[model samples]
Target: MGLLVVAALAGACGYTASARYQPSGATPSSGAAHDPTTDPASATAVALSVAAGAATETYRTDIGNATAAFVADIGTLQEAVDGGDIGAAKSDELAAQAQYDTFRQLEGGNAVNASTLDELATEVAPNGSFAGLHAVERDLWTSGNARADVAGLSVQAPVAQYLLSRDRLTPEAIGTTAVSELGWVVSTALPGREERFSHLDAVDIAAAVGAADQAFAAIEPVGRTVDPDLTTSVAQVFSSLEADVGSLGPPTQVPDAAIPTTLRLSVSQQVDATAAELAQLAARLAPLGTAGAPSS
Candidate 1:
């Protein structure tokens, strides 16, 4: 990509703006005058808003592409398994595994970022971890009617459990932390690296959102309690993650029948929504100077 494109993308990913406010010795109600020129809190909020927006977009895009690829692989494996073509099914599974490995690389070690979530989604896509699951599904499909069991039930349940855990973190927390980090980085980190804020992209945004969603989803249901508002907010974050992924391609399928259809749909919807929200957020955040205006 050209420098402009790269900068735009970077801005969308997680670029931090310069500090707008400087500490002043003046106290507002005393004889001293408060300097409105440098308001740290406002500057920090603007920086965070931008980071959150960019991260959300990047996460959504990556997830969408990864999910589509995974679904395609699952379909291929299912067809082979249905036709009793074990060799073909295994080959498909292998391909999925390769993709999963690539996904892991994208995740890197930043568990709190959207990139990590993108990696996780790629890892669990039907073609990835779920590839071998088709074998079990095939068996269930071919067996005589014993119960109304679905194929890949056992395999999918665990995957869903994992997903649920990953989506437990609240979006507010993720957004807040990401922006805060960006502010700190810009203020304290090297100036040369500060320019990277202009190069954030959709992929980076999606990755950050994905990581946050995963953290939210991972909360234990027993001891963890989410308020209705928080749940709604988190759900929005999840939607953004799925949306970004969806933008890259089609919905990915889960190989295991044990995974609930409702859960899958819910997640897919969240990803799509999250992607849209993130894009908007990025646009809003990218235009601020070190400290121009407070984000309403």
Candidate 2:
């Protein structure tokens, strides 16, 4: 590849504009370049391109750290249990729950197999009947499903979770994904009590929305410049949805499920509508590379 690039450059070198030299022995036109000039719009486009890369990396780093904390919490809980300290084990497990909320940042983002944690739980773990985190949730929180191997699952599960953001996230993937996730949080994940076993439905929804917030913010600076009205609308939609979800209750509170029906439906509708606008913005800028590439 290096040799090919060098050869290509060598082949194309002579075409570069030269002083007092003209192709076909003709005079240069008035269009001949003056000192390189910057068009504000083109400069914005280039900046947006760079921002896309930075934004994607930010998501990657956030998810990576959250996953690490989650795994460590699990390990700590396991050690507490092995030492026969039930109270301490429970404390660590509770701390792990908080980490789980952060882990949901990957929901609908990547690697979880579904858009939301609830749907992800519907997917069975590799060679196992239990799905994603719910598999571990059952063993830890519910009495009937205790598994001696729950601790071992901590490591394997995070590997999958970590890759979802680390491997799959790119600015390009943020397009409709951010809106789709928010919609799912309000529409599907919340009402169903997605984390029924752990009883973290509210936590999951809040975390999921917060994750989408990061994603939207990542693109917002550039996106706003590219399409002012669309970008403003997108930000407003997200803030409205976030406020609604946050107002639902604290992370520790169980989703009422019944009371929020009216509000949930409203948020869901808004999300669907807003997502279309952001999709247009994403298509316009289109990030800078394929998701599988370096994204710059």
Which model scores highest in lDDT? 2
C-alpha-based local distance difference test score of model 2: 0.54
lDDT of 1 by residue, 159-234 (tens): 4223322321123323333333223222322122211221112222234344444433422121012123334554
Instruction: Report the poorest 10 consecutive residues by lDDT, candidate 1.
Output: 191-200
In terms of lDDT, the poorest run of 10 residues in model 2 is: 14-23
Error of 1 at 217 (Å): 22
Tens digits of per-residue lDDT, candidate 2, 1-296, equal 54454334422321112222221222212233421112223444345444555666665676677767767877777676677665566456556555555544344345433322223455655664553345545655664332344455454646645455434344545554665666667665657556666666666666767766767787676566555677788788877777776666666555445436777676566656666666665554442332332221
* Count of backbone clashes, every candidate in sequence: 60, 0
Per-residue lDDT of 257 in model 2: 54
Score every model by TM-score. 0.28, 0.67
Which prediction has the highest TM-score against the true structure?
2
Candidate 1 has a TM-score of 0.28
Q: What C-alpha lDDT do the candidate models reach, one value each?
A: 0.36, 0.54
Any idea how many clashes model 2 has? 0
